[model samples]
Target: METLANLESFVRSADHGSFSEAARRLALTPAAVSRNVAMLERNLGVRLFHRSTRKLTLTEAGEAFRNAISGSLSDIQAAIAGAANGGGEPTGVLKVSLAPTFGTMHILPLLPAFIARYRGVRPEWHFENRQVDIIAEGYDAAIGGGFDLSPGVVARTLAPAHIIAVSSPAYLAGRKLPAGPADLAELDGIVMRSLQSGRIRHWTMRDAAGEQIPAPLREVFVFNDPAAMRRSALLGLGVAMLAVPDVIDDLESGALIRVAPRWYADAGAISIYFASRTLLPGKTRAFIDYIVDAFKQRRLAERFAGSLG
Candidate 1:
């Protein structure tokens, strides 16, 4: 009943804290994880975790087992990688999560080649607006706006994201359109809900001297989803602050106009986020390299027109 495969499942379950999540990560069924953990417990004469419908926790014995095994396992992973790099093939599933906007606009369109080039790579993609806990959710990697990884997990930048203050031309009608950054105080517009966490994601602008300035908020419509905010903005609902990629087409088609020249800010540079360097498959590493090179090749900065640079 006890085998290395079962032990591997136990380790994965302990790491992820949920049998279902571990199963997802391993491409196994939840029942498989449960059975493996049960076999491990029977062999060790102890329970490793407290299981419930909604949560999982390790027991005292389970904690000790992890302390003993986690390192050796990590080493084993390194050995495997070294061998694979030497001559072996890398075959595995790669799971990734991404924000809806970036996933749809940038990532999804570019994934086909990754699949085609790598014959052994299988990918499962998760796209959502809400933030995801990568470790707990059993993801191999992620691409999104915010970066708050758990201590053990790590991340890298895929590209620099730029944001712009935008408004419908119809909303600017008869409103004494703001002339510069300081003039924003008197104007009202739609606001992204995510930007208004306790305080508004105030508009950022630049003066003639190129000094960055903040524009205060007076908003009536607010939504967290950029796509939602974009729709409202297009309907002449109100001026809205949003990421440049979200409104690139609108700006080109004369749907949404820049509110002020100085309001664009390079939202922190975001890149491919993933777990540690251990046990990485060629698919993930190769795909990441492809995307990073592609983004750099396209010159995201030049495309976004940062501060008229």
Candidate 2:
């Protein structure tokens, strides 16, 4: 019979698409994980993964196996953990994925209070600008926009990801201001490329009366980092469409000014993502509640809407 170690190795390897990543999560060597998986395959008499130099892909049997046991494995682990803790305070690592700029500005501030409240929880957080496969990557929660809602996941809206055109006051000093979204084409633009898709994204701006205006933005600089783009705009490089939350401080302090005040692009909601489990882990539950409460107290949703003054 396959031992629990073999089962865990197989599941985590499948989720991560590589033995190295699975080993990192499992705290084992990659060779150990590989050996366990190979042993499991021999015991089961079925091939599970398609091995290649570039990437690991799941076989038909592997897909069927993953679908059958993924949720069940999560439940079993949760049960074991809960039982070990004896329904007491939540303990263990709480892994989360977050966008670098937004997480540092917004969520990182709440950590002091949250840690003070829940001493048993240890946070392992990562900051990046791409959508992560939370379950496969072994994250307890994630915060971002434009993520695919995979099975057994739930999301709560933290704020509106309203995007607005902004530039340094110095850049627009001698230039004729834009009368509408189309006028932006006359000026230089600082745009961002999607880290995941590697695509230069475009936007359709919305007027006060809710009409869509095509923004044929002209790029003066392109960056993969939003913070870098904001910094470039501050240096009088060009105008850029950025999330309102990202530039709130600059807007208030006169470092950056809105180019098209009455227009914004509705990007989507910044959401907090976690597994949808009947018996949710205590640490995960605490974080979700804490963040939602913080948003309510700060009225972040309203501020992020990017409404004109």
Best by TM-score: 2
Model 1 over residues 141-225: C-alpha lDDT tens digits?
7887667776556777655566777888898888887776667767766776554364546557554366777766577777667
Per-residue C-alpha lDDT of model 2 across residues 31-101, encoded as one tens digit per residue: 99999999988998999999988788789998999889878777777777788878888888999999999
Best of the candidates, lDDT: 2
Number of clashes in model 2?
0
Off by over 4 Å in 2: 1-6, 16-24, 28-62, 307-309
What is candidate 2's local distance difference test score? Answer: 0.88
Q: Which ten residues in a row have the lowest lDDT in candidate 2?
A: 300-309
